[model samples]
Target: MRVLKFGGTSVANAERFLRVADILESNARQGQVATVLSAPAKITNHLVAMIEKTIGGQDALPNISDAERIFAELLQGLAEAQPGFPLVQLKAFVEQEFAQIKHVLHGISLLGQCPDSINAALICRGEKLSIAIMAGLLEARGHHVTVIDPVEKLLAVGHYLESTVDIAESTRRIAASKIPSDPYDPDGGFTAGNEKGELVVLGRNGSDYSAAVLAACLRADCCEIWTDVDGVYTCDPRQVPDARLLKSMSYQEAMELSYFGAKVLHPRTISPIAQFQIPCLIKNTGNPQAPGTLIGASTDEDGLPVKGISNLNNMAMFSVSGPGMKGMVGMAARVFAAMSRNGISVVLITQSSSEYSISFCVPQGDCLRARRALEEEFYLELKEELLEPLSIQERLAVISVVGDGMRTLRGISAKFFAALARANINIVAIAQGSSERSISVVVDNDDATTGVRVVHQMLFNTDQVIELFLIGVGGVGGALLEQVKRQQEWLKKKHIDLRVCGIANSKALLTNVHGLNLENWQAELNEAKEPFNLGASDPSGERVSPAEPGDCRLYLEPGGCRSVRGLPARRLPCGHTEQKGQHLVDGLLSPAASGGEQIASQVPVRYQRGGGAAGYRKPAEPAERGRRTATFLRHSLRFAVLYFR
Candidate 1:
């Protein structure tokens, strides 16, 4: 028997509903099959909103009518398309669900209270109503469809929404129930219908979990998760337009991506089918012909270091550190226990090698609870200065890059960081488990989108073009251009196109949006007639905006604003021009500030003489000249004039 699970979007309307019937019929022709269905697209969310409105002492009838109209309209269209189908049965089923829902909403509106049970029952109507409508349609198509309400057999135990299935009991009950694998059976296949027993709905994506459990218990050959998309991509297609579809991946990689925020599959859906090694296929309902992606034990070689990039937003990082934490045995355990008691879920963790600090991430919504928990747990340590007070950093996200092949590939971490660095995204913290299936990095929330895209491009797209803007092409800039020229062939071999988009010097500016010819950029800059101007005023003395950075490029432009320190401070260390002026000076002088003389030695000998404003001048005392020379090198390394103003 094969288990097929259709997500909400799969059977969202009359046309798609008919399409699902066709897919089901085709599957049934192969052998006995059981199908699991989610509510029509967006119905569950609407139901939740309706509940909230009622609880807020507002009229929720509009929401109720909106939901009813959606299903009712689909039913009407289905009837029109299939004149002989059991439309009356479907209509009655929807009416019954709404009647009960209306009664519940009335109570909540009057009492201004939405109990967990009422909420679960209301939310679950989407799935229940969907199954009833679908079962009737299938029956009309001459297929025996038995509706099985999960409460009758799919035993679960936990809180209302976040419930865990009693696997052993559910398995035994399913087997004894003898749910007809063949929809053609005279008795029809067993299904979790609208029987309202202590209604405990599985959380969001619960239908996927339900299908997986059924597939496992029935020992089906395969489980298919039908959704809107073809399958999981390298990144969210909606967010990253260039994301590529992954043909196949391992269960571990899928779970890591899902938990870190892939949204294609629920994180918990894999555990059941994984235990039995049942292959799970994620297919598109809109376009069933697409092969989609397969999740199994052994993955086919794609020759990519990482399979996909995913991120969880609205995250906060907390740190618990102190001198006393060093060599402490049970501090971490106690800290975690305290968080657990407060019902705070820690999503990621990283500890210092010295054992002096333990840092972790939790959802922003749980920030207060997590902070209080840590503070209470480490109160004594904080009092004695053995540990610092818990520090909470919000407005963060965790980006995870997942793939099994990453273990065999060296320098994946370095490349990952380099990709983010090139994009000017900051890494707040990082955590990687020994399993090596994934590397998770915490970054500012605002940078999450760019971080995912750049990381995906770098890791997967071999022929990727990387745009670089060199503001100073004299010494360090000239050397960088030469280095890039030398590495052009090498980078090409690795499928990287290190294209120089624009090159500038103290005298002139040269630009080729397509890409400056690396072999002749020096000649190009020398022959360029346009004078290099930083924040140049036009004929009217109004600011002329610099060209927009290429769709994907590394940009370094001069800062329009200057700091009182007189440092050419508009430099962006990460190579992006957005925050181009904040810490450019700090980045250039970082080495000197770190008490390193390497910066001095790296300066070319020609610029070793004293220097001021226009050119280098020999100064008294060799040491003073060298110092002035270093200052000149710093200035020469950074050319300030052109900025994205």
Candidate 2:
């Protein structure tokens, strides 16, 4: 049997709902097919808002009405499209569900409080509605439909909002239950219950967990998760434009990536499938023809050493250390016990080898609570001066590099740190699992996106990328662009991605992240909207703002006297050095002093044969001089290229 789970985006509208029905019908034609589904897009958010508004002493009727309207419109559209859609029955079911929702909201409003059990029941109403609509559509197509209530068969035990599935008991119940042999089952049954059978849920994004639990209980051959994207990517495709889709990965790699912030799968979704040795596929519902990523026992070892890069943002770090902590037994246990008691989940942890200190990270929203827990837990140690005061850092982010292949490879960590160093991003704290499957580092929140991009490029991208911002478009700059355009094919042959990201003359600035069209760059720059304001604010005409990190600036102005005066030294990715008559400072090229003219003869020739700096060679003939200057301009362009890489 093949078990499938579709996310909210897969069933957001009537067209998508019909598409899901088609997939289920096709799969059911072969053998038994069971599926789990989440609420239509934005429905659960509306449900949550309803509860929040009622408890906050505000009218929740608008949210309730908005949610009801969504369902009503969906059912109406389906009725118009499908002749025998059983619209009346499904509409009555929706109305009855909303009536119960209104009753709960009224109770919460009257008491000014909403309990976890009631909130879970209310939030899961969307899933119930989804199942009912899908079942009706499938049954209309002449297929037997069986709806399994998760609360009745899928037993769970824990907190009402986020509970753990009782696998043994749940599997036993499924075995004994009379699940229709020939029916296509749609289980919207993630309303798991505790030992006392109280209403509970598997947490947010728990639909994946629900599907995995059901797959494990039924012992399906494969479990497929259908979502919006084609598959899991090397990084968040939105964050990294060139993020590649992973064809397959190991179960451990998927778990690591999910925990570190890969949203394609929930962290808990992998546990049940992995425990049962079941293969799982992540596919896109919109593009079913695409071969999606597969999660199995082993991954391809011949590919990139790192499978993926993932990150978690808006984090806070805590440090607990003192002389008393050294060689102290049970100190680590106590530290974690405090966090557990307070219900603050720690995302990453690292302790000093000397046993003098322990450091860990938690969500920024839980910083205050974590601080209080630590303080209360170590009150005696603090009073006795045995432990130091807790050190807290906010506005931090965690970036993790995960792969099962990293264990056997050497220098993976070095390469990761080097990439961050090149981007000028600092590492706050780091941890690597003993399995060598992942390495995580904490960095400033502002730098997290750039850090992930650079690391991904260094580890995954086979081609070298050189982003250039040319400041002058005179004879030298124009010749450089022509040379680049002519050599474009050659660069590609050599696996070099040379992009002219920005071109600026004295008047305007044109920029494109996807690389400008070298053929029409002159016209594009002339019509560009951003003004070239270098040194426009500084009356002295001395300093210009530094270029962004990882960009190489090339200035070939023959007459103008724009200089790099006020640029900070730290902003320079490559170290500052003086050679010949030029100053290669702050990744910029300019004259030696302010108001000094930069002529062809003064321009340095650093990139030459034999890798040694060459001084200007003045030719006697005028034609020879022109050719020589052209050669110098081309060579100078090479300097920018070398610095960028």
Candidate 3:
């Protein structure tokens, strides 16, 4: 027996739904197949909106109407597609489902209370509608389909929204149930299931979880996830055009990727099936013939050192540090316990070897709560100054590189860092499981996509794409583009693809990451409609950004530190140096009277005598007088001078 799961996108509209019917029938023809179905695309979101509107005492008429219209339209379209498909029965089912939904919404509006249990019941309607439609479609096609409701057949134990499964109980129930055996009967897949007692829902992407649960219990040959995409690509294809599809990956690799932002598979979908050593395949419903990725027990076959790169954005990293906490036992326990008690889940964590500080990442939504929880838990330490107040950095992204080969491969970690460095992507923090299944790094949101592309190049030896955003398209920017276009071939030979992804002047913006035509970039910019703004986002929505921290600020400040804070003050002239330190100032301050006047007007400059070969310091006037200063270098100052007089 095989358990197959189709996501919302796979059953998105009437055509897609009908297509799914065909795939199900075809697969069932090969052997016995049990199916799991998700609600139609965006239906869950609509349900949540309705619930919110009801609880807020706002008009839920639009939501209720839209929900009804959505299903009505699908039914109408399905009827048109299949003339004799029992539209009457389907219509009755849809009307009854919406009637129940409207009743629930009205009750919530009157009570002004939308609890998790009620919300779960409301959201489950989407799946119910979808499964009903699918079953009707299959039956109309003259195929015997057995529809199974997980709420009745599958057993789960937990809260209303995010319930945990009772594996033993679920297995027993599934074992006793009569799954479709006849080649004609493709077990009409059902939405969700719960234990006999109360109705409990499996949280996010519950359908995928449902499929895995059934697959594990039945000990199926493989659990297949059918979605819109062909399979899990090396990177997000929408971002990286050349992103290759992954043919096969280990269960651990798939889990790591899914948790770290590989969207093809649900994070919880793997553990259940993996427990029984059942392989999971991520296939594309749009193209069933495609060899979708096969995720299995062994990681030995895949040759690549890194199987895939995954990233999570809009995350904040929280660091709680205290010198007093060093060598303290149970400190981590207290810290994590507070988070747990507050219902804040940490995605990644790292700590100083000395135990002086602990840092972890949580979703941006939980940032404030996580901070408050830590502060309240360690109130005594904070009040006594033993521990520093929580340091929260927002707009950070976590990029993870996953592979089973990393365990046996040497320098995999080093190669990853080196690749990011080459791309000028700064890493804020890092964490790696002892298992070496993956290496995760935190970066500025702006650099997340570039960071992924950079690491992708290093591991896969693919063409490195440099996404450039050029502001000035006149002299410098225009000239750079010309050179880039000219050297495209030369760069390709070096395994680098330099593409002018964006170009803008003061008036308009014209850009494309798929490599804008440099030869006509100027013409394109002229015909561009939108005004160029500092906050211009990538048209492709691929450029990861909070924007790499330092962007062009004070556009007139030539060659100085690019940070807005590093803008030159009116008091100083020529060029602004980085505050951290200064280097040898060459040909800036000279003994020449004209040079002296310039130097006199500038900030105190550091200099090193040419012959002395000594370090830079305050200039010596007696020997330096009447003689031209050969070379001058500034250090730890914000200003520097380079002049020849």
Candidate 4:
């Protein structure tokens, strides 16, 4: 048997609902199929809002009406598309569900409180309604459908709002329930029952957990999760533009990625399947033909040492430390026990080798609760001055680089740290498991995006990128751009990506990170409204703005024009010259002024004066005007080239 679970977006509307039906039907043709589904898009959100509003002593009728409209529209669309869709029966079912929900809301409003059990019942109505609609559609199409209610067959334990499944007991119950061995059985509902038979939910995104439970219990060949994206990516494609789609990954890697803020899968969803040794495939429901990512026992080892980079933002780190902590055997246990007692989840943890300090991260929303818990746990020590007060660092983020291959590979950590260093991002804290499957670092929340991008580029991309910003549009600059344009193919052959991000003349500046088209660069520059100011200073000093630097400038006059003296500064460095005739000085302009001296020594520049060509020369004090031009070219070759490997 094959188990298929579709998320909210996959079964959002009538069209998507029909698409899911098609997928199920196709899968059924191959063998027996069992399916689980989430509520339509936004239904659960509205349900939650309804509960909140009712408990808050406000009118929840509007949210109820909005949710009813979504179901009403979906049913209407289905009726129009399918001739015998049983629209009246489905409509009555939806109305009865809402009527019962309204009654519960009234009770909560009367009492001015909503219990978790009541809330679970109200919120899980969406999944039931979805199952009714899907079953009606499939039955209308002359297919046998058996809707397996999770509350009846699947067993769970814990709080009503969020519960953990008793997989072994659930399996026994499922086996005893005698589920149909037919060609197709579309299971519905994610709400399970506790030992007391009270309705309970498996937390948010629990539908995935439910599917995995069913898959493991039934011993299905494979489980498939259908969502919006084609598959899991090396990083979130929205944040990292070049995030590559992963073809396959191991179960451990999937769990690591999911736990570290990858929205593709719920962290708990992987446990049951991984335990059962069942392969799970992540596919895009909208595009079923796409080859989505596969999560199985072993992945292709030939891939990169790091499979993916993931991060969690809006985090806060707390440090519990003092000399008292040193040689404290149960101190770490006490720290975490307090957190668990307060129901606060820690995202990452690290400790000093001396055992004097222990640091961990939690969601920023729970920062206050975490601090209170820690303070209470160490109250005696703090009162006696044996331990320092908790140190809290808010507005932080955790970035993780994960791969099973990292265990055998060398330099993975080196590359990761080097990437962040090159980007000038600071690491607040770091933690890594002994398995070497993942490396995680905490950084400032503001730098998380840049941190992810640079790390991804360093680990995944193999090409070298140079972002060029031309300061002058004279004969030399124009010639250089032309040469770049002509040698584009050669650069590609050599694994180089030279992007002309900005082009500036004496009049204006035009810049595009996507790289301005060289063919129309001149015209684009002419149309730019940002006037160039040679005398203005750019405080950022990275881009050529209208501001001129206080230090130095270079002017290239025409063949007959007199040489214009450069702006004076405290020191001339090595580019100072007193030439009377016009000369050509062509060199790459480095945006980073601080890096000019270092880059100047690395890149070579060719200089020509008096219609005579001079080879490359080291930067030094020159005796002749031509040699001075060469020295200046060498000094200015500080234009940046960032190599990624």
Best by lDDT: 2
Measured over all alpha carbons after superposition, the RMSD of each candidate to the real structure, in angstroms, is 12.2, 10.7, 12.7, 10.3
Model 1, range 1-645, lDDT digits (tens) per residue?
788988888878999999988999988888887788888887888899998988877777787888999998899988988757788877887898899988888888888888887787778888777777777778778777766657777777777776777767877877788776456321111123222357677777777888888888778899999898999899997655557898898888888898899998988889898999999999998899999999998886565668899999999999999999899789899989998898788899999999999999999999988888878888888999999877889999999989888889898898788777755466889899899979999998867765776677667764544444556553334545566676678767755555666666667777653467887777888998866543343333455344333211122221111211222223234553323322332343343244321110112112111111212222222233234322322222122222231
Specify the highest-TM-score model's number.
2
What tens-digit string does per-residue lDDT give for candidate 2 at 1-645? 889999999999898998888788777778899999999999999999999999999888888888999899899989888778999999999999999999989899899999888888899999999999998988777778888888889889888889989889999998899787965778884568787877799998899999999999999999999999999999998777678898899999999999999999989989999999999999999998899999999968338678999999999999999998998899999999999999999999999999999999999999999999999999999999999989999999999999888999999999899777755567999999989899999999977777887788778876555545566666445655676677667767766656676676667867665678998998888788766533322223234344443333333322112232222222123432222102332123222223222121112222212222222232222233133322323211112322221
When sorted by TM-score, best at the front, the candidate numbers are 2, 4, 3, 1
Which parts of model 2 have CA positions greater than 4 angstroms off?
468-490, 500-645
Candidate 4 — which residues are off by over 4 angstroms? Answer: 466-490, 498-645
Predictions in order: lDDT: 0.70, 0.77, 0.68, 0.76
Query: Which is better, 1 or 3, measured by lDDT?
Result: 1
Error of 4 at 159 (Å): 1.4
lDDT of 4 by residue, 152-208 (tens): 787898889889889899889988888777666777646788998888998887888
**Cα lDDT for residue 75, candidate 3:** 85
Error of 3 at 201 (Å): 1.3
Clash totals for all candidate models = 8, 1, 15, 6
> Per-residue lDDT for 442 in model 3?
97
Q: Candidate 3 lDDT, tens digit per residue, 1-645?
A: 788888888877888888888887888877887878888888888888988988988887887787777777888888999856778988898888878888988999888898777788888887877777877787788777777767666677767888877777777876687665654322223234455465667887777888888888778898988998898888887655667887898888888998999888778888998889999988999999999888898844557778889899999999989876898788899999999998887899999988899999999999889888888889999999989878999999999998888899899899888766645467999999998989999999867766776566567754444444455554333444555676678768865555655566667766564668876777788998866443222223233233121222111111112221211211123343321111111111111112221010111222322222112222333223212111111100112221110
TM-score of each: 0.73, 0.80, 0.77, 0.79
TM-score of 3: 0.77
| Colliding pairs, model 4 | 533-546, 536-547, 536-548, 537-547, 537-548, 590-639
